[model samples]
Target: MIAKFTPVLLFFGIVSCYNVRKHKDAKVPGNANDYLDYVLSLARPIIASSGLDPIFPLPEVTGTFENTILGVHWHGNVALYNGFLFGLSTLTRAGDATLEVVGFRMDFTGDVGLSNVQAGYRCHYDVQGVGDDADINVLIPYVSARFSSSTFLLNTTTTMNSFQILNIGSPQVTFQGFDGLDWVAEAIADIVLDNLGEEILEALESGISDILECIISVTSSDDPNLSIDSCVPVRNVKVIRRN
Candidate 1:
């Protein structure tokens, strides 16, 4: 419950209770952000990223939550898939959440299963960047704190739909000692990033291509209802490279 808990079952279909916490609102992105759809690619689809939020984890969600639902308690947290530790290919937020995030920290316990330890995945190195004009606007779980469960806690200190939007005081991520096995957790992050680095890059490229195509298509479309001029150029892109 961030604003008003509507039984209308909107925004994650929460049929529970919540108190909408109000904070200093941001410059609510213009519908212009929708133009990011123009940068879409089939190899990497924004819709794919859309399917990621609140499922509970990195590149999907970055928030924290604690509440009782259906008369049962639940807890969950998320972290970004940076080069250091790996849980996902790229850091992406599922673009379909009602509550936005500013910034936050999350803790983990038990087996996070964040990496593919079987392979020798470890910090190899990676670099990625997103352009400023490429403004991307998606509802993402920014701030979160959880142990090991399936509930999202979003933090909204500063929000960014594209990489350029990130700043020194943007969202913060942490995966601490879990089940007293800090070493194990560290190992997993390394491996996941090492093994999946290339894959992640490919996916990102595909996704960007798709967004671009979408914009071009609509711009050239015969439908008067859909026009390129209507698209607000929104791009949240990151470039990750490792040597």
Candidate 2:
């Protein structure tokens, strides 16, 4: 039913795993390349560890679908479980080390049931529908991001640009075992899955924002007088979704 799944779990999955700290062997970055390398080294763990297990499973999700032309409406709950997002790896710098990317792969399963459903035109009808199981998987080969710096008032401010997902693969979203009105169930499922790509991308973008914030913190940690605020603007992350 117009899936509109926000994927709050996906965002926190990466953010919760982050532990920003300078390695014992860490040295001050002398150049742009060095700075990026340093950031990557610090970011590896956060990316690799995100959603390795069913840390967050969405239960009791409610949604609705309505088609005025067909005079059909459905409202119900979807319980998503066994949510696992893994295969986050192969983080590397793009050409000239100016752009960076991290791999992405995720899958989840859920139970769907339209406890209250209604369909009508000239004649009105209502019934309960059950969608037994749903399995969703997505593969975005890589998410690329760029970092830039500008000096103002003798303060070098680092800014991270929006991220782009590359080589986006078709997502696999399927629904099975509907107890009533096969076409209605399919229509409802379709509405939900249509927004999956955008929602997933938003979640990953939030994770990247956290990584950049951590890097800023660790980079300036060595100097007590320096704080992340001085070198990075508030909420330095901004992502623009691209079709």
Candidate 3:
């Protein structure tokens, strides 16, 4: 199970613990809704185009269970560049103390490759698989935490209730690995490939963190509470080109 928690708690912890600039009569540019819209305008694009598809290269893989192994290595890269379309299907309140995010999807086409690998039970594992017309659906639920500025509970992480991944191109991966002892790479790939959902979740978490940080940096604000009226808002979404 992945987590849907956001970095809102980090903002709150920093803001509440320290002295946040209180705009007594801060020329409130707009209401809470407007502020949210403004922030979203900045965040949406960054989230959509954050850390994407370098194929996450792993030169040396290491893990431990009973004994430690070394020199686990790999060659070849997974090409995960994309032609994806992003959208916020729905963002609403769940029950009493949670934020529900649904319809956040990424439609992608990429490749998965692992030409060589050396591990305990597996060696020389290789995959030169292509993934096309694949999509990812995410349902994220966040904890209800208050920040320093507004009553917006949408951006904090006190803890996570859950993070769900509905799909990931439903990629059909084919590969083979052999230790020359008596095992098929397909067997291990099956186990790893079957859990692609976790991979998608991991990517989403990193992307969201980047998006939130981008919003904070561009807005020049510490509190992510939907209360600050950003005069120099990030990028006027009006002129944003999804190219």
Candidate 4:
């Protein structure tokens, strides 16, 4: 009878060991929300320490505007320089996301340009003057982006799936020139936006990609399993704006 019971006890012991092994080999459930949070959290500190936020001393821009009002010719040439961009913020949402879909909104502000302007009105008398130190404020609205990522073995890469400009904010330009005529300032602002819009978006994308690359590189350096080089490309990204 003791020999017969020994076989049953042996079977139970073998089954228990197999169950433990199975549990050990099983993969943990993936949590994309946590993944997003972790990476973004790491990014903030890295960006702060690296001094990548609040870009300053923007490139200078110049434009000229001419028009005929009531047969009186009006013209001006202006230059804007020494701009700064700040107030960078990201809009986060509360929801569960898969590894395939991650989205967020980015917003910032720019204080651009002390200007030097030369304007004149010609009809009967010549009115020529120079204005100094114009004030301009650029309000960058929220831009939404959708990104996707995949991990194979120890490598991971993120791609910019899509982006949209929800609203385009107008720049405020105050040029105390032409004896209180603000239209020149407005025209100059329009020109600035046309060029600066593209530049700002490009800078933003590059900056973000660099931050992500830094995060991955630092993390991979610490973990042997994730040491492989990975690229995050954000090129040729199209923008869709709301009508």
Q: What is the TM-score of each predicted model, taking all chains together?
A: 0.24, 0.43, 0.29, 0.55
lDDT of 3 by residue, 110-166 (tens): 111111211111122333331122112222222121111222223332222233333
Candidate 2 — which residues are off by over 4 angstroms? 1-37, 48-55, 58-61, 64-82, 87-90, 94-131, 139-167, 174-195, 220-243
| C-alpha lDDT values of all predictions | 0.27, 0.35, 0.29, 0.41
* Decreasing lDDT order of the candidates: 4, 2, 3, 1
RMSD of 2: 16.6
Model 3 sits at a Cα RMSD from the real structure of 15.9
Model 4 regions more than 4 Å off:
1-30, 89-97, 101-129, 157-179, 216-243
Across residues 83-183, which tens digit of lDDT does each residue of candidate 4 receive?
Answer: 55554324232234443211121111111111121111111111235554445665554344433333321232323432333334444443333343556
Q: Where does candidate 3 stray beyond 4 Å?
A: 1-50, 58-123, 126-163, 175-185, 209-243
Poorest lDDT segment (10 consecutive residues) of candidate 3: 105-114
TM-score of 4: 0.55
Candidate 4 has an lDDT of 0.41
The TM-score between candidate 1 and the true structure equals 0.24
> Higher-lDDT candidate among 1 and 4?
4
Position 73, candidate 3: lDDT = 34
